[model samples]
Target: MAQNNSAFSDSSVHVDVKDYYGKRLQKTADLKTGACIAPAQPLPAFIRDALKKVHPEVTARYYGCGLVVPECLEGCRILDLGSGSGRDCYMLSSLVGEKGHVTGIDMTEAQLELARKYMDYHMKEFGYKEPNVRFVQGYIEALVEAGLEKNSFDIIISNCVVNLSPDKKKVLEEAYSVLKDGGEVYFSDIYCNGRLTEEIKSHKVLWGECLGGALWWKDLLQLAEQVGFSQPRLVTASIPTIDDKELQDLLGDFKFVSATYRLFKVPRGNTKSCKVMYNGGITGAEDVFQFDCHYTFKANEAVEVDGEAASILTHSRFAEDFTFQPPGGSCEPCNKPKVSVLLHTSDCYDCVVLS
Candidate 1:
């Protein structure tokens, strides 16, 4: 595995994160900035019900920026990167069910201990014959070294934890290596308008708060391309407020948003545009399947999709959920309005309007 040789050592960053989440912060209430907490939104009924079953102790320690749940999760093997307190892992356990499995990996021992402490409790609560979830102690940037097989997981999720890594590129690389060809890294993390200075990056409090280590939003595009993943699809975003006056002044003009994006590991090539209709079998999104900020497929309605979207629909786990037809013959692309590009320069903190 490649290590980041910068003014700050990778080991030092790991130590700081462990100290912050393990010793300094006792619960979500102990967090200094709102960047780690996701903004409120109406969730699907099934998701809301699943969350209510998670252990209160585990939910209390959750500090994620946004919900990382993706559709078509019935029997898919999933991995959770930086699965602090196992909050997501336990919730996902119910979604994946008895046949599917969820593995959570976190570096902090204290968090891991708490996660394992409830293993039997959650299994009984979910009424499972046996436990389908397991917790591993490992770093996100070094998953292969941590004993995870390459091309193994159907999906991987991270919530507000990617920014804490000193080498964000390494983290993406590791995630790409572990995912199956049709798999995806669906995650939510803190993103800033522009890159921060080294002075801000060095601040332990700022980094721990998930502000200083945030990636410049544009940089994520380049990183995904470099890592050989499909273009990131923006799902949702919200502005995170820094309430502390001292921290706000220290941040100056820099702005941060909690954003969720999904990057797929599909074949690298251009696929022709096609007409697709959702069959609508996925749980929670029965009537309409919202693919991203730009695309929403109503059940049985044939909509023309771009090459990238077509490829994702046909090649991934969702292939079974939709039917596809070639564009421009019987399908006729002109019948429906083409997807529009929404400009979001003014609402930088709310969402990224993809072109």
Candidate 2:
């Protein structure tokens, strides 16, 4: 229900929103991404591995607001949303190995062209005989229409692009449908802690730029469930601090968090029951923290953190999103993990339930 007043200026019908900034060209960032692009420059360990096989141009032109690569990508079909210049795709190409396939999808023509041009060079650089990469010109929401088969991909990855879609709900549904029974969706995109009202989301420039169009974290979790995904776990988040007092005044409490989330689409998670494991004080915690908690479980449940039992429900089956909390114990805080409800058949295996 937001109309694009900034980009289109038509101000007539309320459009879902394609982009707030405008149509993407060859560049990775625009007005919408703003300072978010700065995060990519640091390049996490996972990101470094992904960039190793890509060309300098690819890295230079890359515009991602989140980290998408984790260690679980072996022999998996990886899909990169808004895969500009095929940077992330090529990174996955090597990680998935020769047996796997990496598909990069973006609506930008110039970016894809550059990506295609470097195909041969990347294949050689990564030591692959026949590059296991492909690029398709399509919007993130139109992936199924782009000739992609259903229930196919093993891992679906997107870096700060999903927020640009006009139809966020539709995108989530399509994503869930495409993953294999035990597959996953590991992505990093901008998510606002509070609501993104119709006014802000309607701004064509913001939507196109991939800001003010972010899904509310709470709404995202609900959508994941509505579309059949478990609770999403936070992999890594860069908390915005007031290191610079001036920047804090302009931004307020609003912070940018680039988290790698995992959602398993299989029924295996339901079988997991509650069990307590005590690893003592947080594995590497410099301070002690108390968590108010509760929970129990059935049988065959495979989720239990070696550290604190209270946070077992927070462990993500997807290798990347798993983060440790309080030390394992039999206290009330150790009852059950949050959103640890594993669904039965007709769904995913390692999917996390984001509360």
Error of 2 at 326 (Å): 22
Which tens-of-lDDT digit does each residue in 1-355 have in candidate 1? 6875532234898999999999999999999889999652468889989999999999999999988999989788999999999999999999999999999999999999999999999999999999999999889998987889999999999999999999999999999999999998999999888889998899999999999899988888899989999888887787787899999888888878888889999976679988887888789888877777668777777888778888988889999998888875564333342232452322433434221
How does each model score on lDDT?
0.87, 0.58
- For each predicted model, how many residue pairs clash, with residues at least 3 apart or on different chains? 0, 37
Top candidate when judged by lDDT against the true structure: 1
Q: Please provide TM-scores, in order, for all candidate models, with all chains considered together.
A: 0.93, 0.67
- Cα-lDDT of candidate 1: 0.87
lDDT value, candidate 2, whole model:
0.58
Task: Specify the highest-TM-score model's number.
Answer: 1
Which segments of model 1 are wrong by more than 4 Å?
A: 1-10, 332-355
